[model samples]
Target: MAEFLSLAEAVRRTLRDGDTVAFEGFTHLIPHAAAHETIRQGIKDLALIRMTPDIIYDQMIGMGLARKVVFSYAGNPGVGLLRRMRDAIENAYPRAIDTVEHSHSAMAQAYEAGAAGLPLAVFRGYKGADLPKVNPDIRFVTCPFTGEQLAAVPAHRPDVTVIHAQKASRKGDVLIEGIIGVQKEAALAAKRVLVTVEEVVPDFRGLHPNLCILPHWTIDAIAVVPGGAHPSYTHGYYARDNKAYLEWDGISADREAFAAWMRDNVLTVGPEIFAERVKGL
Candidate 1:
């Protein structure tokens, strides 16, 4: 059964140093607050997994909280390269991080395979791509049936998978609307699941169908955290903070400035302030 808990307690109880963690949510509901909490708690050496690596993963890598990153495309979305990520990989400033590159389909299939309790994700990808030259995990397998070449990668079964959603019922069921990505699959594949939601209502009365709903049994803990997905939009609750993303390029350019900004804005602050982001609620 899912228990209602504070974000601090949830992160403390669910995550640990050197664990494989996946803070998943493609474009929307990016779980920014949870990532900040992970940094504040000082969790280190995590193997972070996600399809599209964005600002949150960049922050974790910048803080040296991650040892390895497994993803397809990595960037600041519409912006340029993730400066801190680039620094870690190129300059090895904070630390030299390892990377496992894959295509979008490969990662998505890996999540599905993990959820299905499979050891490998076999798919058709990486044809004429140079990723295989760098990542040995991208192996070639011949299908016994058709003899067609298929790529195989290890399943991404994270120790814990964290995601942000719009609402949760008091009964502990979570509701996710707008852009649904690999959240449900990741949660199912993980050993433990942590969800942060904007609000907890008595019942999901007016919510539309076709939305991703995780029953209480599937969730370990649920945190009521409005604006938890800052800098990323949470569908009807808020809009993406374009200025923040743009400003991050400058703030994270230098190591000292990045540490200073995180110390002042993120470390000093808590999830309570995030509620202010969704006014008139």
Candidate 2:
């Protein structure tokens, strides 16, 4: 049931202002192209969700597209801080964005709970952690069988979940291999799923059957975007661009530099350029 479309069309059709969008990827296979397309299309007021929000979310926050962010970690990967996000939070530069923080375990459990159609995720966490003092969402529930207490948080059911995968069969089934993180659960938790892949093949018959595969029926749209996860790497295809990550600290340190960089790089380019950018990676 997945419709194969261009990245621009897929993003425009599935993403909108005020939507809760989760660009789920771990250290690898980050959906940079889809996020770039969303930025190019000027979608705003998004509630962004991720377990680890790296450069992509920083770019979105820098562009002033996000009104809220739900995440466990925010950084530039190996780099120091997400300067743009810090600016928005501390100084309200482009706009004041709200933040809801959680532990890595809680986020993963929340996504799993959503995929399971549960209202909340319950787990043993936050024991002696000060996170509960600040994050009111971290509450406690008593076990029925035992007198033990468990931590609970609302499940994350995003409006759209976008991810970059290594390949997709012509039938629309997606293949993601390397550090998948919560991509699967996030996709299942969302109302709509949009995927970008490095290539589209006739079928995945020769690949390992036990590999992580999302059936065609689960996705709404797919875009063949080679190098779509640029700077983040695509496992068997290329390595992560560590230089870019290092440079981001300087590029995003100032508001003007960040805006100019986005204007020149993101706003001026189309998704097609991603394929070219990955050359020699």
Candidate 3:
């Protein structure tokens, strides 16, 4: 049986002070809202893993909620540079330990290995690359039968995975559009999986069987909240909150503005307050 919890309760229950959390979403869609709630609750020393670290990760790092971030890339999508993340990389006390730069496919492969209880997965994307410099954990191995070298990427089994989706069944079958391999891999790789959905349907039969990305067994908790993505967006539903992203981008560029925004929006405010602030945008 799948448990149904409110977003706040789910986040409060699953997150610890220091844990590795993989977030679902691309550059600007379906960010894990409950993960942000956890960050705002003062969870410290979090290691956030993502394909690309964008506004949410940047803000968390700036506010001192993140200790490390493992990602393939970190930048403002379609915008300029991610000023806050760049500054933190260059400055900030107790600098962040960033990891190897690999494609999303490679990261998903690593998570799949972790989910399968494997030590490592070897491939050929690191022979002459600089990823080893960023993450020395990767090892090169020789295939005895094939007599070829392969890059050994260790599994990234996270403590938890927080994913936002379009819809879910009452029984916890997640329905998401488009590519879901990464989300599925993250759910399987994590010890616990929490999903925030825009809405809840009655049963799995209502959804197209082919669009069923995650089965009920993999999900630990489900929270139904419309507009759960906030700054992000749901595919085939709405566009991203461009105005909100612009505000975040502006605040992220300047220290004082960013500090004020964090104190006003993140540290002092709860989920309700944050939602209210994003109402117009």
Candidate 4:
């Protein structure tokens, strides 16, 4: 059964040191509040997984919380590179983070395989791509019928998967709309699931059946966190904070500045402040 809990308590109970954690969102509904809570709690040595890792992952890696990163692409989204991630890989300033690279299609397949309880994701990818030459995990299997070789990679089964959503029912079923990603598969593949939502409604009775709904049984905890996905937008609640994204380039470029900004902003405030942060947007 899903339990309604505070963001702090939910993170504390679900995540542990050296856990494999995935914060899944494409461009929308990124779990920024839960990520901040994890940082504030000082969880360490995480193996973070994502298909497209944006600013939130950069923040976590810069803090030296990640020991390994499994992903297809890493960037600041519309901006340029993720400076912190580049530093970790190139300079190893914070620490040397082991990386496993993949194509977008391969990663999606891996998550689907994990959700289906499969050991490997075999798909048609990496054809003429150089990733297989570098990443030993990228192997090939012979198709029994066609004899055509298919790419194979280990499934991604995270210990805990956290995601932000637009709404949750009182019974704890989560609702996510607009630009859906592999969040559903990631949650199903995880041992534990935590969801932070804009609000909790009475019931989802009248909503369209086709809307994406994660039944209460699938989630372990629900945190009522309005604006939980700040910078990233909820479908109907708020628009994306474009100004914040533009400002982050300068803020994250310098180590001292990043540390100071995080201390003054994220460290000092709780999730409640996020409700106010998105108001002006």
Candidate 5:
């Protein structure tokens, strides 16, 4: 039997103070609604882990929800650095634990190692570069036979993996499009997995078998939320909320405006209010 929960309940069940949460999706395709809900509920001491952190990270930091973040880059979607994130770094208020800048391919490989229960994965990208500078924890190993130096990235087992998908079954099977490396690996490596989907189908039979990215057994909870990935997109569905993001980008530049936005949209507003505000968007 599988457990079905609302997005809020799923987040409440999986997240805790001082937990390391691995979030799926890229910059514009991030799961902001759930993250926002987490912040609204006041889940403190969160450590965010991502290949590249962006506006969502900045918002979390701005709202004082994130205590630590491990990532390679933090910036706006198309614009360069995110203002609030830059402010956070410049002031050194919310601590940042930086990591090596790796291509999406390399990041997938590292998470794959964690999923496969391996100690580390050896790759060839560490020579004569600044990667080692960002991630000093990565080890440099030489093959005995080839005498070739390689970068060994250790497995990262996060406390929780929160991914927003296009569709899910009542039994917890998830359907995601495009690359499933991070989502798949995170599902396998994390102690618990919480999936928020735009729609909940009766069963897997209605969905294309090939589109089923994750099986039900891997998910601890399945949350049915229509706009779960707002500010992000669901493949074959709606596009990201670019207008909302642009608004956030503009207001986030000013401390007073950012605080007000957070208070109105995030702190005071509940899920119902958020849904109402984004009804036409």
Candidate 6:
């Protein structure tokens, strides 16, 4: 059963140093609040896993929490590069983190393989793709049945998985309604799952048809946190805070500016500040 806990408690209890953690959401319902709590707790040496490493991972990486990052595409959505990540990779500012890059298809298949408890994800991909040369983790396997070469990547079985959802019933079943991504696979593949939601209602009985519902049995913790997906948006709750994204380009541009921004915005604030993020919507 999923136990309802505070954001701080959930993050502290669920994550540890050197753990592989996945915070997943496609474009919406990204778990920014949970990521913030992880940063505030000062967890370190994480192998961060995400299909797209956006501002959330950028902030974590900027804090020097990550030792390695595995992802497909990494950048601020609609913005240019992730400046903090660039600083870490290019200049070794704060810390130098190792990166494992893969194709979008490879990542998707890897998550599926993880969810299936498989050792490696195999799919017909990377044909004429040079990613294998640069990423040693990417390998080719010949199918015995078909005699066709296919790409393979190790499954992503994270130590912990965190995601933001639109709502959850008092029973702790999560409801996510929007551009559904691999959050489901990521959560199922992890040893532990923490779901932060905008609100917890009596029951999500009426919100069933279109909403992707994860039964409480699949999750370990539930936290009620409005606007948990800040800079990123929730489907029905608020519009994307494009202003924050644009502003972050400036805030994360320089080392001093990024540190100042983290101190002022993330390190000092609690979960309550999340509600203030989308006041108008």
Whole-model lDDT per candidate:
0.91, 0.93, 0.75, 0.93, 0.72, 0.91
Per-residue error for 30 in candidate 2, Å, reads 0.4
RMSD of each: 1.4, 0.7, 2.4, 0.7, 2.4, 1.0
Residues 109-218 of candidate 3 have per-residue lDDT tens digits of 78888888887877777667776777777778889999888778878899988888877887778888854647777788899898888778887665566774688889
Instruction: Give me the runs in candidate 6 sitting further than 4 Å from their true place.
Output: none
| Model 2 TM-score, all chains together | 0.99
TM-score of 4: 0.99
Cα lDDT tens digits, model 5, 155-257, are 7678888887877766667888754536778778888888777787777675556774688888888776666667666665566677776777788889898
lDDT of 1 by residue, 106-173 (tens): 99999999999999999988989999999999999999999999999999899999999999999999
lDDT of 2 by residue, 1-281 (tens): 79999889999899988999999999999999999999999999999999999989999998899999999999998878999999999989689999999999999999999999999999999999999998999999999999799999999999999999999999999999978899999999999999999999999988888899999999999999999999899999988989989989999998888889898889998887888888997
lDDT of 6 by residue, 210-267 (tens): 6688899999999999989987999889989888889889989988999898998899
**Per-residue lDDT tens digits of candidate 4, residues 1-281?**
69999999999999999999999999999999999999999999999999999999999999999999999999988988888898899999699999999999999999999999999999998989999888999999999999999999999899999999999999999999999899999999999999999999999887899988999999999999999999889899999998888888888899999899889878889999899999978
* Superposed model 1: Cα runs more than 4 Å off: 278-281
Least accurate 10 contiguous residues by lDDT in model 4 = 242-251
Report, for all candidates in order, the number of backbone clashes: 0, 0, 0, 0, 0, 0
Q: Is candidate 1 or candidate 4 better by lDDT?
A: 4
Judge candidate 5 at residue 12 and give its lDDT: 88
For candidate 3, list the clashing residue pairs, or say none.
none
Clashing residue pairs in candidate 5 are none
Against the correct fold, how does model 3 do in TM-score? 0.90
